[model samples]
Target: MPQSHPRPYGTLAVVGAAALGVVLAACSGGGPAPKASDLSSADRAKVSTGGTLRWALDAEPTTLNTFQADATPDTALLAEAVLPTLFTLDQHADATPDPDYLTGVEQTSQQPQTIVYHLNPKAVWSDGKPLSAADFAAQWQALNGRSSAYWTARTDGYDSISSVSQGAGPHDVKVVFAKPYAAWKGLFTPLYPAAATGTADAFNDGSRTRLAADSGPFTLSGLKDLKALDGAAVTAVRNPHWWGAPAKLDAIAFTPAAPDTRLAALRAGKLDVADLSRAVEDGTPVAQAASVPGTVLHRASAPAFLQLTLNGGSGPLADPDLRRAVAQAVDRTAIAEAVLKPLGLPVLPLGNHLVMADQHGYEDDSSALAPGADNATRHLDAAGWHLAAAPAGDAAHRAPAAAPVRTKDGRPLGLTLLIRTGSAEDVQVAKLLTDQLGRIGVPLRTVTVAGDSFFADHVAAGSFDLALFSWPAAAFPVADELPLYAKPAVQPDGSLNNGQNLSATGTDEVDQLLAKAAAALDPSEAARLTTEADTRIWQEAPSLPLFQRPQLVAVRTGVANAGAFGFTAPHFQDLGFTGH
Candidate 1:
């Protein structure tokens, strides 16, 4: 999912951070490299019970439904606590059946690509209804993109399902795909109850504010059930009917606040955990938080990476040659250094758009589009964009003021870049990009929009020539990322459905390769097909990868099984306080 920040897909709350000084010291050869995940791993026996965890949220979720178009990362954060998923990702990014929700899962037939999910007999919703196949069937019908009534965010794997039915028992769900779908495990995550998805009206609006039922370790805590806190937005209490390991914390309270204000709350002991990812903009809070008693910092490469999205739907970028020129004009290495250096993380520019550098199947397919002003100028010149007349001077002694400007057919080569209003990361990237593009004789101006409306109103709406944002990396890359690069299709009603491809760029070849990759059962075959598609994406210049953003989190020392979870989904039941 494309978001303003690089939050991991399907991840719960970020745990905490290691001391800023420690991370700097490590980077400066005072210690070893950072680990994949820095959460204080501990066995269940070591975790103490009976404490409320005060978690900070970037924003209050506009909708509780993760499948809705308006749903943000905050919505997914809340859903992880109260909803059930068929599978969860481990530290290695491998999908494992969540035993609490699924007893077992087996492929029944390869002909129609049938799969049978054995649900946990003890699993039941908060309304005392047993978890059954009906929920899966209803959810599939709502999100398979077969009807116009339901508005789903993405229908990658679900759209491949031909039918979802009950097996021999009520707790068994049998899913039959019309085509072979390799990323079957990604479907029905955070499954909704049948009651919510039974109708188009309820599926769209019922979970917008509150959930009708839940089947996870925590249940949505009602306002009347507990006293209100000063700034908390929502709260979740331990589910009494949870059949698996009970929740370690008595309750989890979500308090919404800006990134810069969270550290102050943490210092005042109001917030138990706070994300410090924004420390790249200002290292002051990170250094200052290290002195706070019982505070620790942890950092890791976030699953998501920042990228420069070029809108190819219209404007000067509608020409593929100009898009390539824009891509070559970007100095990815310099941009990564500007953002990651302050956070004490290695500055390595990402090469592939489909997969992160740390993820499996990652390969540098970015060799074709090298970043340099010379390359940009060459491409622009080849596209018939010539330099405008400058003040005559000795070629060797020309002043910076006499730098060449690109023009074609009496029009100057200029573009508008859209970014979030208060995002320091976006502003910093924009500043560096402005300088980079200017050197190539192109004028790039930035338009700042409200953070809340950045994606819905601008990026997704194709209202800008360029946009800077991050996409949350999914465990199932081939299936999850297909929409981000797939070509926009004109509907029968003459409307364009771009899905999640904010760049408005794609090729039929790329789409065919992605489709083959999605259906490739062999891991090697899938990897090869995905790499081929990524290479085409680079040539098309839809987006240029910058680098993997670091997930920096600060927390009290006693917090365990939390913080900087790189790719693993946090186990809420395993999260608790340990007496220090």
Candidate 2:
């Protein structure tokens, strides 16, 4: 996954446009979401640590390895509890070096963009081994993309590094970059111990060989199964080898619950917290969780977003105007409100490509749709599309389901839309979109792709006329934009590269500009170049973000430091329950 925020469901994003007014405060619907501080806080007066807090994951992870493309959000969250990454993002979107691991991190030289990392001498792996320079060197080689033995989904930041050398101390590491990369912090995230990623066989088999606590607040506890659990629930207790402030909770368990059953589990007090996203189910979980007494839904702005990717191949959507009209015809407001409002999430769409709504250097760029069905009709008419007159007849052709679909050159506008199964929200959104487009004379036929192989098979093969999914984010936004929109490239496995899988759409201009954005030394310059590239993306209308998808969570009233976390990973060491 290489830090990709994988979700079982989809989300929406907001963007700003001049004519349509693309500001965050105005365009994003719904009330303001909760602050990270709010959920992470306990009644300092009533706070007492040391109790088991049961949490719910959207799905069980296949492997404990978070670097694999097959890894899910559950695994990523679990990794945060065990892995000791060198850095973590603060609410301000600034990368802060974790004093628990690295005492210092800075770029010492600009000629080659040399960055130095100073590890704390007191910090030791759970196995009691010193966190040394060898660990850093091995991780760099395994992930540098130069080795074919390791199966890594992404190699953005690592690809820019020219060399890694030992620093003044045994615990110090100096890295030299081939080019200046502003998002350098992303390289060490979800970092694995050197013992795990040292060699080809070790990188593949070593990661899974051990799972007990090695260097985090909570260790495997050997209390039960750790990384070994998949179908069964995962459990972890306070690490006996911990050398820092002790973890608030004695043990934590990530119990798996189907989206439909999560609300019941929360109501039953079977779980203290659960990730109940609208993209997972319709709106029942939100309303149900709300009705439950002692439960509060916490939402924060997330980088993930729900979007409609129009096929650029031989389809009616190949026409940019048609794509723009589709954007207009499908009501974003209706979609967001219907699906997110009940969950108490913002309906505002994130319009920018380089950053999330709450993140710094982010602004709305999505308002270009011209804002309604009237504009949609205008665009369609311009593209030689004619709407069939209202069907006037008996029940066979009535107001419901029966309508005069669109026709162009005497051919009816008919298309098949692929929606992944298992997401109640996806099905609902698909139905709503079908109805909305139907009113506009666009006849949509919906189909369900197997959830397991949806992206690997259907999307990569371009076996779709229309598709809906979430565009997840990593610690760095620009790192993902290139693959998402760059020209399509096939991998050695014969599978479509995930980034180019969206209708196999790409352009040399987009690729070059994205590369420029990645290498830009000036922060303002990087933002400027990426924004310029976004303008072209808007014009092409390849895929437009609907809203800034809500990162929603329902937790027990007294629990603290556990809720809907955005760009930053959850700090399990600080989580606790406030009670006697």
Of the candidates shown, which would achieve the greatest TM-score relative to the real structure?
A: 2
**Which 10-residue span in candidate 1 carries the lowest summed lDDT?**
17-26
- In the range 1-580, model 2's lDDT, one tens digit per residue, is 1123223333211110001001112122244432322255654445577888898866666556666555566766777788786777765355678888888987899888898999888877777888877777887888779988887655657777898888988888899999877677766766677877888776665565355335788876463433456556677788877777778888998788876788778888899988776524654655555666788877776656677778875577767778778877877768877876765565655566555666555655565446578888888888989987765667665645368777889888887888877767778889888998887788899989876667657665567778887767544556545666777667898754545437556667877887787777666677777677776676666776766666767888889877877667777778888764
* Candidate 2: Cα lDDT at 488: 64
**Relative to the unseen true structure, what is the C-alpha lDDT of residue 211 in candidate 1, on a scale of 0 to 100?**
74
Off-target runs (Cα >4 Å) in candidate 2 are: 1-40, 43-46, 221-230, 278-280, 283-285, 368-372, 388-391, 395-402, 489-499
**Which ten contiguous residues of candidate 2 have the minimum total lDDT?**
12-21
Query: What lDDT would each prediction earn against the true structure?
Result: 0.76, 0.69
* Model 1 lDDT tens row, 365-388: 787676678988998999999989
* Model 1 deviation from the true structure expressed as Cα RMSD, one decimal place: 6.3
